[model samples]
Each structure stands twice: as C-alpha cells, then as structure tokens.
Target: MERIKIHFAYDGTDFAGYQVQLEKRTVQLVIEQALAKIHRQDIKVFTSGRTDSGVHAIDQVIHFNTPLTLDCSAWRNALQTLLPIDIQIKHVEKVDESFHARKSAKEKIYRYQIINQREYDLFKRMYEWHVIKPINIDQVKIAAKRIEGTHDFTAFSASKSNVKGDKTRTIHAIDVLEEFGRIVIEVRGDGFLTHMVRIIVGTLVEIGIGRRDQSCIDRAFATLDRQVVGLTAPSHGLYLWKVVY
Candidate 1:
C-alpha cells in the first residue's frame, strides 16, 4: 500500500461541510465517492481539519492509503476529472505511511473577510460579510494585537461545541488590513476550537464599530465566558487559508 497526500480547495457554498454526513452533500463524501470509483472499492480520506458549513478553503490538505500504485500527477488528474467542479485538486504527492494529515499539521492560517461599505455587492454576497456601518480600522488593529499570543480560547469557541481537554491555544500572529472596500483579518495559530476564528473576528468587529472597547478581549479571557465576547461572525466570511506541516 502507498500513502498519498493531496492539496485541494473547495467552495463550501453548496455543501453541508467537509465531513461526510447522511442525507447531505459534503466535500468529503463527494471526494470519497469519486475515489471509490477509481479504486474499485471504498476508500476513506483523512483531512487536516474540518471547516464549518459555508466556510470555504484555499489550501486544505488530506491523506489516504491506496493499494494501487500510480503516479502522483496521474492521481491528481484522475481525481480532478472525477470530483465535482466546486472542488479542485491543487497538488498531489506520495508520502511516508506514518504521515497522518491532522497529526502532522504544524499550523493553520485562517482569514475572515468583511465588506465595510454602504451598498452590498451581489457578486461578493456569498464570500464576504457585508457590514454597512463604518468600521474604525485603528481600533480593529489594536484589538487584533491583543488577541495574539498564547491563551485559553474557550471564550472564542462555540458554546455548543463538545470539545474536551485543554482549551488553550497559541496564536502566532494576526494581521488586520484593508484593501479596496474589504477588511481582511488573518490569523495564524497552532490549532483552533470550533468557531474560534469567527468569534475573534466578531469581537474585533465590535471594537471597530464602537460597540465594545479593546479591553473586552482581556475581560473575555479573564472570565472565560462566551457571552462576554462579541457576536460569532457568520461562517461564510471565514476561510481556511492554508495548512502548514
């Protein structure tokens, strides 16, 4: 058997999420179905991480074992032909059998996009969060800086998530930038809890809109309460920008 690694991207607008689910279309399900056809048997793929519904990905990674030996370039070409148009295979290569996708990941970068303009662009409705109110970029930057470094991110995670064990996570860096009419918030971290990036973006948006002060982030960390944080920014605005191993 040979282990293969693939780098891919997907538009999550039409899928339930990355994982397979009953009675729902998902990125994983489609990819597996296509692989099953090629391998002439059932095949399972492991991903670096899962993205919530409507959360797109630009550089997602996955690995799977197969009995059939084939060139990496041929595997990429065949998989691209079989998979749906919304999912694109970016690169593929053979790897050691011990290289698991999720466990081998060193870091991940996520980006939240916002269009802070009066009128919403119909074309960008699916990809960006449209906020009509003018945002204070300076305040957003200050809040982003405060969220960097290691801390317990339970306050930023979804209350409904049943994640056990430590909630502590280290955020290596955060960049808040404005280009054209879009405000982009990029965060690089070792790992993340459910909705953590979205929640952080929401809190920053509150700071930008004057709804909350910069100190609110500190308070959220001190209290470890989800309610103390700002709104959970919608999933559509969040993207899995890259996964580093």
Candidate 2:
C-alpha cells in the first residue's frame, strides 16, 4: 500500500462539520466519497484535527493508503474534479508509510475572526463574528498574552467534551491583529482541547468589552473550572488556519 498525503481547504458553512455523521453532510464524507469513485473502493482518511460545524479551514491535512498508483499532479487534478465547489484540493503527494497526519503534526494554528463595528459586514457574515459594541484591542492583546506558554487548559475546553488524559498544552502565541475591519485572533499551539480556541477568544472578547478583567485569566487557570471562563465563540468565525509538522 502507498501512503498519500493531501492538503485541502473548505468553506464549512454548508456542511455539518469535518467528521462524518449519520444523516448529515460532512467534509470527510464528501472527500471519501470522491476518492472512492477514483479507486472503486472505500478510502479511510486520517485528519490532522477535526473542526466543528461551520468552521472553515485555510489548510487541512489528511492522509490515506491506496493500492492504485497515480502521480501527485494527477491525484490533485483527479480529486478536485470529483469534489464539490466548496471543497478545494490544494496538493497531493505520496508520503512514507510511517507518516501519520494527526500524529506527525507538531503544531496547529487556529484563527477566530471578529468584526468590531456596530453594523456587521453583510457579505462576510458567514466568515466573521459580529460584535455590535466596540472593543478595546489593547485590553484584548494584554489579556491574550496571559494565555501564552505552557499551562493547564482545563478552563478553556468545551464544557461537554469527550477529551481524556492530560489537559496540559503549550500555547506558543496568541496574536490579535486588526486586518481591514476584522479583529483576528490567531493562536498557535502544540495542541488544543475541544473548543479551546473558541473559549479563549470569548474570554478575550469579554475583557475587550469590559465584561471581564485581565485577572480572569489567572483566576480561570487557578480554579481549573469551566464556569470561570467566558462564552464559547460561535463556530462560523473560527478557522483551522494552518498545521505544522
């Protein structure tokens, strides 16, 4: 069997999420179906990570094994032609059998986008979270620094999650950037817990709007309690920005 790695991006608004579920449209379902058409057999894919419903991806990595052989360019062109318009095949390459997409990933970067004006961008509504009130970008930046470095991220994870084992993860950086009219929070970390980036974004937004203070970060970390954290930002505004191996 030859191991093949694929890189793709998707507009997640139309699908349920990244994972396949019964009676629901999913990214994995569509891609696997397309691959099956080419190979005339079912193909199983291993992804770097799963994104929630309505979450987009700038670059998502996956790998699978197949007996049928094809060159990288042919593989890319073939898959793109079979997949939907919303799902784009970026690159396809043959990789070593030892390489696993999820396990080989050394770091991941996720970005949460927010429009900080009273009126939202009509066209970009599906891609960005709209904040009716103005927020202090300075406060948000200060609060974001607290989340950087290694720590226990128990308070930032989703309240209802299936995560097991250690809750400790090292966050390399949390950068808040003002691009055009959008406030984008890009978080690069060794790994993330379920809804970790969303929860952290919500907490930073609270601090920006004066609903919470910077000390909240310390409190949440000390308490190790989800109740101490802020809201979980909506899925639509989040994007799986990049993955590093």
- The lDDT per prediction is 0.93, 0.93
lDDT of 2: 0.93
lDDT by residue (tens digit), candidate 2, 1-245: 89999999999999999999998999999999998999999989999989999999999999999998889999999999999999998888899988999999999999999998888889999999998878999999999999999989999998777799899999999999999878999999999999999999999999999999899899998998998878999999999999999
Q: RMSD of model 2, in Å?
A: 0.8
What is the TM-score of each predicted model, taking all chains together?
A: 0.98, 0.98
TM-score of 1: 0.98
Q: Candidate 1 at residue 137, lDDT?
A: 94
Residue range 154-244, candidate 1, lDDT tens digits? 9999998778999999999999988776999999999999999999999999999999988889999999999888999988888999999
lDDT of 1: 0.93
Off by over 4 Å in 1: none
